[model samples]
Target: MEFIALDILPFSVVDDVCFRRLVEHRYTLPSRSYFSDVSLPELHSIVETYIHELLAMGVTAISFTTDIWTSDVSPISMRSLTAQWVNEDFVLRKAVLHAQECAGSHTAAAISMAFEKMFETRKNPKNKVHAVLRDNAHNTTKALEECGVASLPCMAHTSGNR
Candidate 1:
């Protein structure tokens, strides 16, 4: 299940002949339905808990990066939120807090609402946010302002910076 999630592979991959043969030699493969209906949720919960634990352990501040993009194969627009911070061990760590599909227009209000929801779901206090790195879209800038969080333009996206 972790492999499927990490590789972004379809749950049905477990049913593939080559995949089954490779793993069936030493382990039993569960049905695709089991992975999709049970293991996926369990994996998500475990990862979420681990991220929370890491953040709670002497992490003082967090920077966030957020963006929205449309899939080439589909009309789905996904908004992603990622958090970065230095841990107690002095190691820089980052986690993708959310990558959810957006239903409507990518307006400032919509972007702000999505960011707030991601923070709320992770139980992260907005006060802990140091800054948000984002694309130089007017809506993105306005959204950060609306949320009262500092915003930095993503240098990679700036013209002639890369």
Candidate 2:
């Protein structure tokens, strides 16, 4: 429920807790006292393991998008949209890579390169890239075009602004 509130609602973590408190006085927040801190190397190893497992399962091809943000200390942050080809029918599955550094055009180019690497790792060199759906960012569009990937403007954005 905490994750759901964080992902789908505009409320902050504290706001979510407060909301739950308002609904039920007897309920208590989950305890964070028993968690183990994972080392950076361990985290990387786990991610690599998952990637290899995905590749072994015949996942290939991908599409990407990026969002840029500024932190309180003026550092740039990025959120990434990544997708993989699933099954023989070509339905795409996606995951988010959050709070990465915003590198502008380079970030967009990196996403394309990541897809290329995923294709190579899956041994599917003939993978078809259908489209990159993103907000109308010039650098991102340029990068996608340069990578020989077609792009489509985000329809949700166009609709929201209409």
Residues 1-162, candidate 2: write the lDDT tens digits: 334323654424424656666666676644222111233345555665765565446555555454445579865656454545565456555554333555554465765665455445544343445566777666667766766767788888678877
Best of the candidates, TM-score: 1
Which window of 10 residues has the lowest lDDT sum in candidate 1?
20-29
Measured against the true structure, the TM-scores of the candidates, in listed sequence, are 0.91, 0.51
Off by over 4 Å in 1: 25-28
The best candidate in terms of lDDT: 1
Residue pairs in steric clash, candidate 1? none
In order, the Cα lDDT scores of the candidates are 0.89, 0.54
What C-alpha lDDT, on a 0 to 100 scale, does residue 35 get in candidate 1?
94
